[model samples]
Target: MNGDWLLLGRDGRLSVYLPSDGAALWRAERAPAGPWEAPRRIGGDQELLPGLSIGRGPDGYGHLVAWRPVGTDRSDLVHTTHFRPLLAPLDWQPAGHPNKQGARTGTPAVAVDAQGRAHVFVRNGGGGMSMVAQKEKGGWEPWRDLKGRGVQEEPAAVTGESGRVELYAAVTGGIRHWRQEQPGARPVPGEGVDAAVRPGTLRALATSEESTTVLFTDDDSGELCAWRPGEKPMPLVAAAGPGPVSAVRCVIDGHDCTLVAQRSTSGRVAFAAYPSQQEALGAVWTESGPELPADAVVSLALDADGRLVAATLSPSTGQLRLARRKDEPGLALGPWQAV
Candidate 1:
């Protein structure tokens, strides 16, 4: 399979694009390099609501999940997997039943563990958080409610070095965390991590086997902060700024780092980096890249060559633009060129 960068987004419809060929992978039968292949329309004729989640499975396939409304108040969680071969079609399947009588909520969050099993988290019809996993043999398990009322957003999940899965979500009072120590283990909620973070702004990055980093915006100050397993939320920036609209954890120059795309109060979008997991709280965040419009929602991913790629959506124009930076060392993003 090719190690090219894969980007997914939705603007009236869902689409997938390969921005560039990082390695010399065979091209699709008739497709060539440059200007992403005509985006493959994956949403079909259905009304694809916002909130698309993508994860790479252990089998080297990419898994995607999104919510599609069925009735006035109900929506179903649609799933699909894609392979990397040039021109390989995306095979989307109805993973399971609708979200508990068609609950209207944010997009579901999916995480593929080292074992290659996918765990999906979302808000159910009753306004509680729920989850369902794909069985090892095949098929999906029934929906299991984790029981949290007034969930403000979809849950974020990541697998640890010990094979334990940790999940995080914003609740009525604060952010709630749960952990499944092992496969089939009931998810146990942790002590209150913090209550100062803004709802729906939580993003988790599992930087290494033994540690995971949580990033969110302060509810009162709007400043960016970081939290680890047993530490208090420490401010990464002194001044108030928009929390990360999109972030990703990837290795750069053999160092585990986080790339964050944040919007300032002045309505400018720029990229920042947190390079070391060990000194995350103390390390200075290096900012770079040209500012995007305030309305642009961005997503971050690392190409096979470890370069950073960003996809931005302009709501006013309804256009999805792709860009990348290759020369910067560490977290200093170079100038962006539209792909």
Candidate 2:
């Protein structure tokens, strides 16, 4: 599962972080439809774990957080950032403590708040939630646990419409959540909903200041479900395989909509667009492009030009394949091409 592998930087460029022997970056200038630049590997010989969690603020600063292997089984949560004048040197720093505590951290889910501070959440070694954030002045706060049991890996964290940071994770029987009452406030436990959430598939899309819609697959049935605060769980289409889905909120033909991409039954990328937060109105799934490898994971994001971009990372070649929404009516995408 991707913890937000692709992101749109402030300079109107879209960058995808690849977990190779080290952290690598591929930048496309004038994105949505881009002129892709050569891939540049960042960092020294530090070998990062597979997932890269990316977060950016309105001011355009971007941060990447991931687990870098320490000893045999432990890892250090390293965070790196990029701002203006793109040619600056990159620094990877271990947040909180190192592996000295014998903690084996998982991939982190990160989000930048209104103040441009990166908030990172990861499943701790004790099967609970542990988090670290960038202090307002500078530097990171201590790693603290947001108590919960049986928390899954790769929680979905996002800045809400009001700038408050919120998070959702797939827990034992359903999904659990945490949110800040206001911007820059510490996140406390929020109301959690009971649904059959597939671990690593719990994704939250913040539609308003007070609530976020969470989407996930049923662990037992493989069907999709959407859970909104104070609303009953709504059932969606079935996913042909067992991977996470990518969702982005954008305007289509002047109507607010949410675009979702998942693995089709035929092991290809499929897309669907529906009224945002109006799941009961129904959505129709359409498969796009030729078949991808059965294990390929797909994700979606809005490019700098406000175009909906759907992407899948090739498992065999490690190349990122991308397609953007067509300018015509309905849910259509241009030809899939490698970046």
Candidate 3:
């Protein structure tokens, strides 16, 4: 969602969080708009694993989680936060490893609940999911098992409109899921839907105030499919993209829409817009723009002006690049710019 990377802060400014020597940030020079600033590393000497997971709490702090390599082999998850009036974040705090020996597989997922606690999830070295959340007063709870093996990739976690969270992991046979028993409480097992999904393509978007729908490419055919926990997976397109898809809900041409995009086989970003929950109606796909630096993490969000905007890390330049939906009725994106 918004906080995952290109965050629209409470102050109405935009902050693009990019992974770097630790992590980097690019905040809009002006609120509600940006001639973005040069990249600023969050200032830790630690080397960060390739991806980052950020959750913006209700209080406006951006809680960040990522894998920190411990020595040459083992690694542990670390945490940090950034907020207004402070461009530099607090020091990286060790959130600890899931395995007593250390967790080495899967990326971390972060989501902040209504009560302002940040929750982190990852597939552990034990071949199961592990989670850690903020305790009532502060700090983090010990890593606990959510229990599921064969997790294909990084799990997807999202907070519903109610501030409760649900996590989904694409596994060997189907989808594995967990949901908070109540807002801010520990998550419990939930019904899972059987489906064949590609690893690392799993993404969850809240389709309604109370429910979330996950999107992923079909493992066997590369088709994009969407599903809620109890429903059968619904195909959204005959073929999707080569990488994980990113989604954001917005109003397009006066109609409520869910816009999705990913790196296509041609190496450029491909996108589609469909009425929410109406994927059965059909998704018209469009290919646009040049390919990002290989393995770029793409993120989309509606600006305060309510326009579609996307940002991706440019590993080649070690900076951030951006593109916005053009001022046309269709899925046209203006030229990309290094921010």
Compare the candidates by TM-score and give the number of the best one.
Answer: 2
| Candidate 3, superposed: residue stretches over 4 Å from native | 1-3, 21-31, 58-60, 101-103, 326-332
lDDT for model 2 comes to 0.75
Measured on C-alpha atoms, candidate 3 has an lDDT of 0.77
RMSD of each: 6.5, 2.2, 2.5
| Global fold similarity of model 1 (TM-score) | 0.79
Q: lDDT of model 1 at residue 241?
A: 51
lDDT of 1: 0.59
Better of 2 and 3 by lDDT: 3
lDDT of 1 by residue, 1-339 (tens): 111124332111122332111111111212221354433455345455666666655455566676666777666777766555343445455665435564656657777676777778877666777888888787788888888777777567766666666777777766777778666565677755656767556777677767777677778875677777677777765432554446677667777767677555554556666674644454334444455566655667665455666666544544455566657565545455454
Give the candidate number with the greatest lDDT: 3
Taking all chains together, each candidate's TM-score versus the true structure is 0.79, 0.92, 0.91
Candidate lDDT values, in order: 0.59, 0.75, 0.77
Candidate 3 lDDT by residue in tens digits, 1-339: 223577766676677776655554545545465576656667456777766777767666678887778886888878887776226677788888888555467788888888878899988887888899988797888878989878766788888878888898888888988999798778998888778877778888788877898888888877899998778888989654567788999877888789987766766767899998888987877877666666666788776677788777665566567788788896678888876
Full candidate order by TM-score, most accurate first = 2, 3, 1
Whichever of 1 and 3 has more TM-score, that candidate is 3
